[model samples]
Target: MIIEPLGGSYDRKAFSCGVLALDQYLHELANQDVKRRVRNCFVAADRDVDLIAGYYTLAASSVPITSLPEDLTRRLPRYPVLPAILIGRLAVDTRYQGQRVGSILIVDALRRCAQAAPASFALIVDAKDDKAAAFYCKYGFRPFQDRRLSLFLSVATALKLFG
Candidate 1:
């Protein structure tokens, strides 16, 4: 499989992650969002076919320092907010669910965040459910105090893992 930016040629209708919202976003809004410069989306496609196997989106974001754990906050500058990259959406087509496509997409997202200009301090993900949160936790993401499904991984930690 090859990972590349979302393009007009991709067969979005053929992709389904078992979630209506996600599927709808890809089929309806993904290209428009990209055209508007709202978020950057990347898709994993089959080597020979114009089929999208999975995809993820990234955008600039911030987190309040006060919302972070004391241990994490104490080490950072006394700024009110910390810069971050939001993994806005991540989904694997049902046909590609067990093939590690999600894992590859996330790792690719983190690597891009780590290499982004202006430099991000962390990677944030708003997981859709408990199962989604658990998947992120396995990658060392920690839940924010305000929400169990909202999780983050420090860029320092991500660099160690993916740098």
Candidate 2:
């Protein structure tokens, strides 16, 4: 049940969340992304079984201010883009889906972004599908004006959640 940086001990090839792309990313690409400093991959790993229960990737990102709903942007500084953190991917092994593994991973991701060295105003995610989008909405993420599957939640709120 420990969520830590991905390492060689976990059986990457054994993870399958019913999505081919996500499964491939974890099996074939996550380590490269980490080594390239492009994204940080964290996994909920079980030491005894060498199994990965779930995983997520985080990276620095930005959002166009104009893409946000007017009600959300009207009070912000007029910068064209706002600094943010992207939860590039998140997936739970089918065996762990009903166990709140995804929720735990997202909370961990938000905590990291809230305490990041560089400031980030929000945390964003591009859902792979409508069902995934609904999971994020439970955490208060709002959709972008033009991207229904893309959503964001304020860092301030994340801070409040664990303050």
Candidate 3:
């Protein structure tokens, strides 16, 4: 249950976890531009460093204020803005499926974002595909109309949703 920033010699093992546990479509997407976004990882281990439970990435990002619904924009202060991020990606490892590790990773992601990113308006992620979309949607994330693969959760909303 040890969760920390990704680094050290365990990267190869972690990336392999991503490649094998996540669908091919997601692995391919992660291999491209998305990798340049927020890339953070969480390692769950036993008494020894196993890097085995699961991991996910988080990065900063922005979406135009105009991309949000009119009501949301109006509710915000009158300045052009961008939503910020603590994106969740590469969320898998078959060895730990059904152990609720994914949920813990997400909770860690949100807590880190809320505590550290004051300029960030929301936590954003590009769900690898539809099934991922539903997973995010379950947590009060809303799909952006123009970007079908993307979803966002306002910091306030996310904190409340998870609490």
Candidate 4:
């Protein structure tokens, strides 16, 4: 599958894939969030908009060095830097369900995130609900100890798994 960054118009199919109102709102907010870094909005296909399959967005964000467990933080070079990329949203259209589209989107996101490693410690995302949380958990994203809305995976771990 090919994944290309989408912009310049609203993506109704992507909104439908989100599966709920809040998720749709979140997808829309990404387009409106001016403080975010370049939001890579992906639209998967085989070189045509007619083949629009699924989409996701990626943006730069930071996690506190102190939010990480010592095992991960202790190995990093001493600095206050805590680079991260937020997988703001990922959703596969219902027509494409059960065909590994979600997995493709995730691996694509990880691959993109990996390209910025060493400078980044982890990839972070807020799963919209328990189901979305479990999907990410399967890929090794663990919830922050006290934050139900947040989850993260170390860049090292992602590279080893997705590379």
TM-score: the better of candidates 2 and 3: 2
lDDT of 1 by residue, 1-163 (tens): 9999999587799898999999999999999999999998999998687789999999999999988999988788999989999999999999889899988998998888877888889999999999999999989899999888999999898778766
TM-score of each: 0.96, 0.95, 0.77, 0.79
Model 4, residue 56: displacement in angstroms?
A: 0.8
Per-residue accuracy of model 2 over 54-139 as CA lDDT, tens digit each: 99999999999999888878889999999999999999999888999988998899888977899999999999889889999998
Q: Clashing residue pairs in candidate 4, if any? A: none
Q: Ten residues in a row with the worst lDDT in model 4?
A: 7-16
Tell me the whole-model lDDT of each prediction, alpha carbons only.
0.91, 0.92, 0.67, 0.74
lDDT of 3 by residue, 65-139 (tens): 877877677778866767597575646566676788777777777888888835678888888789888888877
Task: Give the distance in Å from residue 108's predicted Cα in candidate 3 to where it truly belongs.
Answer: 0.6
Q: If the candidates were sorted by their lDDT against the true structure, best first, what order would they fall in?
A: 2, 1, 4, 3
For candidate 1, give the lDDT: 0.91
Which structure among the candidates has the greatest lDDT?
Answer: 2
Error of 3 at 112 (Å): 0.3
lDDT of 4: 0.74
